[model samples]
Target: MSGREPIVPLVRRFSPTLSPSDDESTDSEAVHPYLFGKNSSGWEVIEEKRRCVIIADAGAGKTHEMLARARYSAERGRYAFFIRIENIREAFASAFDVGDAESFEKWIGSEDDAWFFLDSVDEALLQDPLAFEEAMRAFAARIADARERAYIIISSRSYAWRARTDRQLLDQLLPYESPKANEIGEEEIEEAVQTGMSDPNKLTNSIDVVILDDLDEDDIRMFAAHLGASDIEEMMQEIKKAGLSSLSSRPYDLLGILTKWRSDRQLGGRLGYLKHSIAVQLDGINWTACSIDPSILPEAVGRIAASVILTGKAEIRVPGSANDERGFDPIEVLPDWPRENVVALLDCTLFTDAVYGVVRFRHRDIRELLAAEWFADQLANPERRAEIEAMLIREKYGERILTPRFRPMLPWLVLLDDRIRREVTAIRPEIAVEGGDVASLPVEERRSLFHSIVEQIAEGKDDRGARDNDAIARIAHADLSSDVAALVERHAENDDALFFLGRLVWQGQMTDCLPLLLDIARSRSRGLYARIAATRAVFTTGSKEQRDTLWDSLLEVPNKHA
Candidate 1:
């Protein structure tokens, strides 16, 4: 089962404790991923809640788990069906022998205890966003109008919960305050789901949201052992030694690591892993089997990826279509390449999935990474950079690069364009947190970019002084530990800065911040909250020796302060 069985993984039901002000969100709050939990996974939740929305990062394996759930239902002799968003109309029309999506919508929820796993809403949005949203709301309405009898599960790449109204529409009990890293545990998982069915008046109306956690150590090793990787222990040790423990924790990234395990290589950062994986995948091709050169695949795929960025479309439908907004023949982008050969190669590649002749990168993250690399190469030219900036900002043309879908690619864009510095600081400072880690980048430039954002944080306290533990923990990527540690040291006197630092330490992979936390915890001059925050972090992540030192400091605290 890959240790991914549906179970009651830790979940944060909307807290009943939200204050009135929690309903209002600022700009930054509008784009954040919600809390992720580990426990029993999507399978159990689907069985328990008649309607559930599973959200996760791209490549966190939502599609795979959904299929598994469908199988589980079938073995039990329950009716179950899986649907992808791209071919929603075609698939439904084919299944029910109907004419179009509208007719199919009318036909769904026709069977009681029937489970419909609607997958890949994010990819659908990338193509036809308005249509996708309407389809979901419509399908949900169909489920609702059916006397609330049909079972349903939906999954999406993490999209920001845009408004309080949106939260209410989903029937979230209360707005979540951007979760903290250490605030969750199985014991506190919101009473294992309270859904619309429990309330007689609200049956099937509430769609409870759950995010699948990344592969924990046991899950990672299970997959490794399942794959029969030689020297699994050595492989795990090597990954940890490379400071890639964070990346390896992700199911998608872990599979890449395990599949390409070699005692000799350093997987490097995310970009490095991509490069290595690309080379390895290219190796899987037998050049003698065809006229196409191995290098051609990357060139073609890279161009296709860049096209996706400019168009905000993930699919390149074969032969094109008059009605498909996302459709484009591959040859249209690469006028020189043979359409059949390129599509064949792409379909064979591990990194892509071809559904009913419509091809998409296996995950949006892959698409974003490839596009980033391609754009970085082009942005090297000053004139091209100017053209791109104009187009991205114009909002009417090539592709709106400023959209949230493009955020993953912005760090790569920033690497080549100096003019984007303001946007980096003001719009998406998390760019610095993510980009600081690439093995190939210049550390000084990234550090400079990060500190400017930190200064912005120094501006003032958050309205409620609530910690966005998820956002803060994201900064604790192992590669960024030193950069974060330096920033913490620089802002030891700034309570806000210290507060952010404390969060990173306990809730994040902040191995480098222990000494600094100890120093602050032992300092009598710091605020009680700051000292307490630092003390918690020290005790949480410190070594036995470090804990002994912290214990000694604690003993002296009353007398020393007195």
Candidate 2:
């Protein structure tokens, strides 16, 4: 279960829309082409058409599906070229000497006998849309007649391929406001579409569009079984109870959950569970040679993640390399450790060596989570906090101190502490205006925003509110500043605010806020909602002595209903 399991989930395939006279079906049908040879016969029909567009969201197993297809084709005596679309040009250049269609056909031996799996076309388009489109058009033109000789399968995100009715696929593929589309007349547009340049639907009259369906109950159960869970039904119940149904359907998220469940049976908060799972992975790695303290490994990894986020580069060069001048050395963060040991520790888990000896996290989500955790840890150090704040503020004025990808880290950044939240809002005031950054507003506005946010959380008006609360819990666990403590005290009388504050204190394990919670728990003036929240917070967060006193006070109340 640690390494990727070979269990292929069910997949659904749909044929392009067609006229009734076309005698083609548009309904999606479940297929197990990767698992059973008999089902692959239908895949052969798709292969005969020699063109397919696989569409799915991020982490939806599009790459895995394409890889599985390639494996199946290989088993059937077909040579499968699994090429990442981002490197498609390089792959083509290296594989064939001639650029023309006839040369390409001759190079492959028999076009009809080869299967080409082009993965992540959307990534290529995202990096350089215009260049990708031009290259794709040229490639398509070269292989247009070779369709019978080769099968070409390309994968893209749904957003990248979903064009307006009035907009041709080429137009959508053009860079934002690029004049290339305007330069092309309708005739050229139609020609490009017909030639299958960017227009996946027009690849052929019988193109198959396979949209990956989310995992169902059976898939989840089967996957859980693969993870070696003792009771599949109970695991499914826990997944549903955690409101992780949508996440469970995704392969990566489901794997993360399974990883955590294998280590710890208790299903906690999503972030905590994911972090724990990552820790378990790291712990299981044989790092005795590194000689680094296990306790500080997460902090070191978090620092690396922060560097990746700020630099906007997934890969980090090894220490002492010419590209490592940006203070990316693990020794810079873990001063007590040997440089080689630090490198070994980094190579342990959660990261893999990339091209040129650089390293990158296993997943973007893991990087983001670790960056957030690192920022939270930084809040306790005034110098580090100030340094980060100055850097962020400088970037706000377009100095480009941080990468644009760093923006996703903001939600997690603000959750470190109220002071950190305030600093972040000052850097991006629009966040406050949008009701997302509440700590920097004027006292009255902050109060209003806090109440609104809490109400939204209570009513579940926005799915994002839960994420916000999760962030809030991260910072609340730390000791609160006096100013923030006072703000909480003012709202302690308001039942909604008080309940939210109690939950924050409980979730954060805020030792500084325990006295207020204790007061509320012992008081009669506060309503039932406030008192109940306070009682829970005290019992969950207070010291043993404080809890005993609170218990005695609760028993002393003559009317338990009151």
Candidate 3:
């Protein structure tokens, strides 16, 4: 009732088919040797057994085998659910148009005759290991009842499988050793990519299980043909020589290569040159290297996003005038992103529906990275300085007047010096002293400006007892809490300020300021503020007297609020 149902036990007698091995003998002349191989005999046993687990290393031909079995079962007119385990719950539910519990029951009908193909079981395990085990238990129970009528097939990365020793369901499967000449061909690949077989037993008579020893040979030959061309092909050869050939396996990398070639049509004219360019970029790193190598990609991607969002430039143009005798600057080579880092940065920048990709840190994470003190220190270099300055202007300050509300734009302003300068001219600007400059004004003048701005916005508003809600929210996130707090203290009975201060109190507990955070938390709310005060009192405040005072204060809040 909770999860998926158990597969029914096999009731009908089926031949005990053995998994094919070169040494194994076949009883039926009708069975295709290519399809079943040695395990051809095990088909009977597998069918009778009900549930099954198939384990193999990466590139071990598990997909080929799963396809073979799925095709066989489907041919028999049985409803076959071939699901990739990456999205197990959704996949199962969709198959039955039911929830998880109902899907399990459907798969584990009383008669016990269903085939479920699950690919990449590791994904489910990685997300939630407990649910995976529970699901397997339900599967095994149903398989026991269904016997020859029901079964489960699963494929997972061998490395992940080796990690969880407690999974008894897998321990029972105990994988068969991989064969020596283990290779899957185009025929098998095509069948898998297309729809699979319907009938398990009648497969041999219905379709040919063709096999070819060579798989990638045709793709290799096509590459050779492209290189034989005269023009662009030569460029491609150079790129290959430079090391770009290694990225073909990654879809994104391939897309990047094609996109780059398209943008530079002159280079595109020669196919060879394009290929060579790809080769040069991808030369040192292959798919495996991307997966296994220690990565600087995250940092690199952060830098790229920083350059774009902080600096107005897209990083795809030449930095300086080309007429100068200097060779093309490395930074100006256009789209000069570090290839290995693109994936990491892209992950952080692009927010999407949670179900499709890995969950990411909230938007605040990017803000924190950009606001790091290191970035502030490096702004002296023209490029770095330009990027940071542009970022501050775009994100923090705007034209016309100073905004009275503190929105944590200090994360931007913090990078610059204390003496904030005003632009003398809008058209072609130079720093100038003017009434517009917040930093240039004396303390009294600045406070008067701040108060006037607030009064103008709050005129005739019922919310005068507190700061603007939006303003308070912004203040709560300010980088320099002291400065923000000082600004708030200047106002009379600003409850919105207190509320914002409370949030900062909470954030501060997670950040640098801890001891003083309690004061801010307690200063905010009279009632539910008890929770925050209690947490602080228990963990941060040292003396029992302080704790008691805080607890009593919290207890008194309810009566007072009531």
Candidate 4:
């Protein structure tokens, strides 16, 4: 056996900090330690509950971490089944060589702690996400209804779940703005219907969620040490730079960043970081490698990804599958794309040969990022602008680029074309909440949208409660530009909406919201949660005199939520 130190990545439980409707009964829950050691505690945590969903950003090592943990569990004589969601059809088929249906049933009859690790929820079943949803529900049902005492774990990207991340884009998930019954125009009603659609968070709402935290500096240092870097101090210096902090924290990107940094090339944002990873592969460094031109790879892969994702398929192509009605040919995605160059990349580290001759990017996130980037960049050229834009925007609701598969392209498109952002926001306020910075928009429009968002957050709505909160949070960040004072007014004036606002202000003591919060704290009309949240928001950042004043004033109020 090759004896080497195993690096265990840190992970944490996903809390309900943003969920205002949560019940206050989580105190008895396991306080999952931020750090894990060589012992099997980290692995055991998965079985502590029946279902767990582990989420992280692209290339952050979700699959690797889960695999490592599963291996560790198996070595410890625990029952575990690792299933790549995409291959569920053949999962059990491939899971055994000697066992037939009878043997498998017998094995399951006696097995407990037969953990199932569903790799990526976003990529669970097929290239097409529609099929993925069906498979995901089936698996969820299996997990929920399993007679065996089995554990299940699924993972997904952050943006796939929420807009809090730096990489979030304009989401097409039907915004909180449901069309009022009084809308005068048919087109506007259609637009509202289109903007309001699905809420995916419900997919994992019943299961416990744990976010795999980004590797800290020490973790990065350990990784660098394993890579045999002699001057880690200087490497750490560069890593600490504001630009690379997020990049350095991710294992896959860290490897690429360090490898390229040694060459003394300047790296900037995600585009540069992701591009460099593929560049190293294209530099002819590994098996089945070619030193073909690196400039076109991103676009080649992007075009292919766009075609696949837009078509509602996993976007994977199965070669020589004319008889196999499941998918299409890779070359057909973009007729003008360089076929020879794209085909060359199909077998390299940058891409993987899925079962049979089917091909896809070795890294899924890279394909998505490049697809969005390529489409956005194409708009810069006058010749391709109309074709790309029209292909993206469709008359069908939630189809075309508006689908989740194309969510990555939303931010890029909005940023590239400001006028479209304004137009979409005018049609529906909630859609543009995720578009980008709110401070850049005109104040009057922002005020109008803010009111619309508040109206959208009306009491007793389940489908859009969280979406409305996210819209509010996005607008809250515009302390510099948006008219937040309007929110303090009888905007909905409902306890739920106020609690949502109080939670936002409580997040980090947004000082501008201090006065309104203090008022809410003293108001007898507000609900207990709303007032307590307002009180805590003040104590979190208010002066000693202000804190004491609020504390003393709250003497008569109940302490339930505080």
Top candidate by TM-score: 1
Residues 139-201, model 3: lDDT tens digits: 454445454454555555432342223233444432222222225454544554443433322
Looking at candidate 3, what is the lDDT of residue 390?
53
The window of 10 residues in a row where model 1 has the poorest summed lDDT is: 11-20
State TM-scores per candidate: 0.71, 0.53, 0.28, 0.62
RMSD each, Å? 8.1, 16.8, 26.6, 12.7
- Kindly report which residue stretches of model 4 are placed more than 4 angstroms away from their true locations once superposed: 1-43, 55-61, 89-106, 124-133, 136-146, 156-291, 315-344, 347-365, 377-390, 396-405, 418-509, 518-562
Question: How do the residues 1-562 of candidate 1 rate in per-residue lDDT, one tens digit apiece?
Answer: 0122223232212111111124344322322222112334445545666656676655567776776667667667666667765545433442221123453354453555566777766666665546455565655544555534556666766443222443454454211222333554544343334321233323334445565666767777777777667777777788866656766766667767765676344455566676676666656654444568776677677788888766766667754324343446667788886655664556555444444456666655566666766776666777797775654444535533355556656655655456664554455455644432333456665455446556666665332112344334434545567777887888889866686667667765577788888899888789755676687788888888888997897777375545
Q: Flag the better candidate by TM-score, 1 or 4.
A: 1
The residue-by-residue lDDT of candidate 2 on 278-381, one tens digit each, is 77767866655656567877877888888766654445556655543222455555677677766665565576543334555655556766887787777678
* Model 2: per-residue Cα lDDT at residue 473: 39
How many Å off is the CA of 267 in candidate 1? 2.9
Q: Write the per-residue lDDT of candidate 4 for residues 402-448, one digit (tens) a residue.
A: 33445544543454466555544444455555433343456666566
Q: What value of lDDT does candidate 3 attain over all alpha carbons?
A: 0.35
lDDT of 2 at 14: 31
- Position 492, candidate 3: lDDT: 24
Question: Which candidate would rank higher by TM-score, 3 or 4?
Answer: 4
Candidate achieving higher lDDT, 2 or 4: 2
